[model samples]
Target: MTHIRNIYCIGLNYVKHAAEMGNRVPEEPLIFSKPTHSFVKTDGNPIELPADKGEIHFETEIVLYIDKKPDPEFKVEDVVGKIALGIDFTLREVQTKLKQNGQPWLRAKGFKNAAVVTDFWDYPGTDICRNTEFSLVKNNETVQQGKAENMIFDFHELIKECDENFGLDQGDLIFTGTPEGVGKTEDGDEFILIWDGKEKGRFVTNLK
Candidate 1:
């Protein structure tokens, strides 16, 4: 099991994604969270969608693991840890209605099986912070692609914001939002993330 103490998610981090979703590029990062228990095993365990939770959608993001407390004052290089490309699964209908009514939208995103992550890859050392890539391939075609250089709120900024809102500690996670091409998911769909040119089998989601 992947150990997770707290989960923090960043929304609208990618400028293109924000525009496509009809949102403005935020002045700062938009952050959300999935409960610690929401992380399911990707060690061959299937991703199950909530069958009754309206229409389920998939958003691919680059996930960060916090190794230490973040500093609002220190340079970004000092706070981040390992990285992984993960899915921030969502209930699109639930979210849209909530947004219209001005409600907290966690209920639409932070549900059981709403979060599933791949094994962590060590953060590209200080020399390489923005070269990482996040790609989601459905079936055989590339559906979404986001680069670190493209994030409106980069990892360091997100960590600072996350610590600002909730104190950060070892074992906390920060999911740095999704890129464009988010769409409804179907049963037996396999998502493979082409992370920085490397192929990682995310899941085929045996949704029941």
Candidate 2:
């Protein structure tokens, strides 16, 4: 099964998303992980919602496919194998409650079909920052747009910080945090991730 061996995620990599979520932009990157098997690709099944987790939100993000084997001594530019667009599904209500109680949000963030990844491209390390643009279109209207220029930690810096905290392994995937326009997903919502002005792939969600 061509699946990720490990998964590392950057939380609030965008300042606007952090402000919208009532969090301060951190001095350092906040990290999380999902099960490698949670990656839902093109042939992957539609996203299924949990029955009781209120306000399921879709966080459209940039995904990095790690290239090399796990190496604590590796450089930032050598870490990413490829780059893609992905959606990080979150049980927003559950997350808020967990935050209130000072609890870890693994259950709220990591669930079956949690990581939805689109197609990937070999974005050269030198040129990723000057990206043309990427956007998420819901039901045929653009809902979220992201650019590498807007990222708080950017590409090389994010990879460097992530590798410092968690030694990235081969078959590892990194979910860069979403930008501002996150919201609830209704049944029949069609999400298309467009990369560099082209349609990469899409993920449709089902209501509970």
In terms of lDDT, which candidate is strongest? 1
* TM accuracy, model 1: 0.93
What TM-score fits each model?
0.93, 0.91
Candidate 2 lDDT tens digits, 91-143? 88888999999998888888887888876777567465446588899998898
How many pairs of residues in model 2 come into backbone collision?
0
Q: What is the C-alpha lDDT profile of model 1 across 22-100, one tens digit per residue?
A: 9989998788788876786556656788777688888988778887786547655566677777889998899999999
Candidate 2 least-lDDT 10 residues: 123-132
- Candidate 1 segments whose C-alpha is farther than 4 A from its true place: none
- In order, candidate lDDTs are 0.80, 0.79
In candidate 2, which residue pairs clash? none
lDDT value, candidate 2, whole model: 0.79
